[model samples]
Target: MTSHGTTTEECSPTPPTAEPATPSPGLYNADLAPTARKGRTWRSYSIFTLWANDVHSLGNYAFAIGLFALGLGGWQILLALGLGGVFLFLLLNLSGFMGEKTGVPFPVMSRIAFGIRGAQIPALVRGAVAVAWFGIQTYLASVVLRVLIVAVAPGTASWDTNRFLGLSTLGWISFLALWAVQMVIVSYGMELIRKYEAFAGPIILITMASLAIWMFGKAGGSIAWSTPATKTGFDMWRQIVGGASLWVAIYGTFVLNFCDFTRNAVSRRAIVRGNFFGIPLNMLLFGAIVVVLAGAQFKIDGKVIESPADIVKTVPDTFLLVLACLALLVLTVAVNLMANFVAPIYALSNLFPRVLDFRRAGLVSGVVGLVILPWNMYNSPAVISYFLGGLGALLGPLFGIVMADYWLVRRSRVDVPSLYSDRPGGPYHYARGVNVRAVVALVPTAAAALLMAFVPAFHAVSDFSWFIGAGLGVVVYLLVADRKGPFAEASGEAIAVPSKR
Candidate 1:
């Protein structure tokens, strides 16, 4: 929506080229290529559902309970979630703008800031994080499968006694089954993903609502709004901040790539409206449901159960069993593909455009995720938090630098071809193929955030590390980077419409 440099002026049209009208998809190729002019309004709906699938799931529920466990009251936890969602909404809008402007994926867009060759740094950072999450989500889905299997075939629980590679035979089978389901869905690419999300999101929402209702009934109208027993005193604020930080970290990873979907939007307005409904409103509502359900569980079961599978296991009705299994299976697959699979596929493909196509990149990501065995990764909360903190720290600086360059430095224009061109005179080319000022700002800010993550003395700072890193990056780049003279001219050229796609 924001135009950067000079506007295009029609000239006495030259004869069209004799070559075939079908241009090569080039470096920005995707399974769902964005149209030069948008048409799909359904895409806005699909994206809205995408966020719903993201927020109305096991991970989201667990995160809410985790916040409550921090000693924060329901109101405080809701406030934290609301604040985190506000940040997420704004970040997504910026990232979405990039996609709409460039019609490129996250990795391709990084070329502006990181240089064409150097773009791999952000790609690898995003890809590695995706792979880690992929494995963890896969393991979680497998746990759901194991539950269903034992529910149907009661003797299958005996397999738990015979362990291999730190898991039972049943666990391995369940894990593989879940892995296979996700791989199959993702292999179909974005169209299938869109359809899957549209359906799965509603089903998951319905099941969660039903579960919440049933949980309330089981609690005998005595579900008091009480904080988790584990938290105490000022530690409640500490916990609330920690929960907010984790929420930001989760959303920040994908914020960079949000434009991948937004590029297909009918208009920037659609993207904004979708984000408003999907992020803050949806997350807050889901958080409220989670809090109510968690409180109900505490009253009914004598403890808080974060996992939906764990909560559903307490239900006795045979009819409910069928619905719960179906809901969990569909929801897990949806989240795994949307949140973890797609981004990494694009990230890896960007690393080597010619050889590694989207499908190959997806396979590579899946294999790497298998290597991590992320069930082990999520075993330690502190380690998981630290890892998330490190990734989140990078996001702020990256966002700051990219947004500043596009909005302030370049105005709004982007040279699409030059983004892929590797020659010396290319718009993105810089000395030694990296922006030193951006790096200088990014590195120290990330270091500061990481220090906060690991050091108990810096605990207060840790909660706001993303903001700190991002703000510092913006300030440092603005001050140190040569914004006057020749550099300013180059910045203008980068965005000017020399030609149109």
Candidate 2:
């Protein structure tokens, strides 16, 4: 019998080579099982490049340059990015530790807190948001791809100008083409993703640096760092805080399911080392380049062009323009796959471990991303706000509950076998395989956060909706669930390290 008191036949298709350590059939599938240490080949540089590509993208470029519009100087904006990066680094570490130690994905780790069946709730919520982002990122990447299409086929200029479903005919072709390519990439699974990210991240990082150098040369090598609207004193501090909050909010989705990648990490040290260079340092370095480019553009054009693709188009050299466009396209795809693709793929796989494997789940996610008509959603500020903010509120609570339960209530002990066990009286089984207290705790906290997002009266504090939900989620879970009875501490070894074999 495998662990969780089930025979190997019931829990998995293949008989176990090692007894007790292997996960069960119902909750355990090859996709969700603990990753073998031998398979954990992602070094710190793999992770660093992952962040490098993730940070250097069209949307991120726009976000960084647009901060000047908020009256923040270059220094203040860099400071804000740094602050957000620190918060993001800390959160990724806390969430990643569970995965690195136990070698499980986020949805699987959630079982320890939400019960086996109940884990589906958070999984589905995260999946929905991921699907939305997948579509949005695909649309954004298509915008850059349109540049290539237009450049290659000058006759398609008419196609670019004509509009349908809020996107031009050229836009549709580009979006669908990029969409198909990404599906093929995901079909190959995680190893391909790791390798692709390693290649894509550093190339785009160099491309952006080159673009910055070109912009500086255009401006005779000297540019003003501060904009005309730069603010100071109390107003500056307020913008700094808001900028920091917005920066963290931008990554709220990745923060929740970071373990999807960390599970492949070779060690806790690898995870930390990668995240350090990947997040804060990389963010600051990229932000600095963005500031310099924006300033140089303002000097030449009398206004900053927020879209990097648009900036690329202004270049007179055909080769550099094509190269920059291709680099931006690759950067967009890198972030989309790394930030938006993996989470939903794993979430859907966990939803029906028996029926859906990685490739199949990726197809489902890709289809959903295509049909969402993401261009419409991405074009609207109010809609994006409500959509992302509402989802962020819901996600924050899940993070809070999982962290609180794992670190505080259970003291990090995980009966790995119990996570897959559907049997009554199993450690994670709870009442009817559902943790009602967790659901009960989730309701009010999520509701409170959602209200902050949806209600206009609460707009002032909506930026902090994630913080509110997470804080309330931790407090409420601790209040309702102590280490006794249904919430008893896990008994057994604290963790079963994944086999090196």
Candidate 3:
């Protein structure tokens, strides 16, 4: 399955290594599959549970509610969500294919497009973003802890008043505690993560379902979905686009990286089934639950509730409230660790593979996340928008270029050895170990998308920046590569051309 370009080579039909019952040293071993254990197979349902955990989070809840505030009706919002999910599903399938074919992690597989050395560019960018998100999610999880503490022990409310470094004393304590707990689990390795997700995912889903049912009963058996008062100048079309854009931004980051988990699947059918149940199906169900719950809160309180804490505050039963809050807190922490923490750890570790092992890379990323003070990062909406928005722009182009090179340009074949080798004439080798064609396309495309994000006049275009960057990168990379004839020959019959439905 070798492809065009000097780097293409067929993979030997060697079986992946068997998963050890005990933990193994978590470092890149030349003889081992880049990021997969040999024989462990993740079932399709387990993958669905992964998506269930991903979607059932405080951040995801907030994002769904934010879409309603974009001036679209419930039906319109659903349309946007559906459309975005479809786009994300396609992209994820493409990325997941590479993982299935090569049995590599996202950062390692990226070497195919960015060159063995150049892969670090996308890796670092994605890693840095994940770190910021990790801190923010940790902080968010702590908020639920604070609420539960106050609910159960009223006297401890004083801890919320004493402030340091923009966080209350209790806030810092909860943050550190949650951070440590997650570290313990992550340190154990991916098997532990898989186990935790399988358990936590279902619990969160049940809780959310219960919350939705309770809200419905509390609102006199009806839910009224409406925009928040804080939002102004509503337009239906704009809302739809805005809703779709929000989905794209959140899903885009992981769509290209999900292979980090999916590659462990027993088969490609398992990955597809997991994705089917996860993205479109799970997201829609979760979004509907969130919207209904949020809308119910709005009718009862006469104001839209953005935070899960706010909903928890309104619950009457002290014991049930405490339990729910605790569950939500645990759920948030789980999602943060799996989604935000793991991505960056692997991304950064690939940079200095020998010196920085997985655990050390994770610790370094955690420390950097703490230094950033994510609470301050979230304080200003405008600042958060620009920061996240700029990063969002990069995701589309990176996904586009990587997939294009793998499926269209280089074909399905990837040289596993060259991915780690520094030898000249290796498949992934480029001048100075960087692919200028990828850079030439990635830079300007990303810049254009960023400009649309920061500049007010170009704000409308910002929502589709992912699509814009992806399209631009694909076009530019194709022209620059200029090996069209060779691409078809190398691709052979293995290339799965994504239907643009």
Off by over 4 Å in 2: 1-24, 161-166, 380-383, 485-501
Off by over 4 Å in 3: 1-38, 225-235, 380-383, 482-501
| Model number with the top lDDT | 2
Who wins the TM-score comparison?
2
Candidate 2 or 1, higher lDDT: 2
- Name the lDDT of candidate 1: 0.70
Give a tens-digit lDDT track for model 1, residues 49-139. Answer: 9888888878878878876655666677787788889888888888886776555667777777777667777777777777888899889
Query: How much does candidate 2 score in TM-score?
Result: 0.91
Candidate 1 regions with alpha-carbon error over 4 angstroms? 2-35, 38-42, 228-245, 380-389, 485-501
Ranking by lDDT: 2, 3, 1
In terms of lDDT, the poorest run of 10 residues in model 3 is 492-501
Give a tens-digit lDDT track for model 3, residues 269-331.
677788888888887887778778877877787666686667777789999998898889878
Please state every model's RMSD to the true fold in angstroms. Answer: 5.1, 5.6, 6.6
- Ordered from best to worst TM-score, the candidate numbers read 2, 3, 1
Per-model TM against the reference: 0.87, 0.91, 0.88
Candidate 2 C-alpha lDDT tens digits along 1-501? 123222222433332222333355667776777776555677798878888998777777888888876678789989989998999999988887667656778888888888998999888888888888889989988877887777777788898887888888889999999999999999988888888999898788899999889889998887667778889898898788877887777787877888888777777778788999999999999888988888888888778777777778887877777788889888988999988888888888888888888899999999988887888888888778777657767988888888899888876666665676787767777888788889999999999888987888998877677777788999999989857643332221223334221
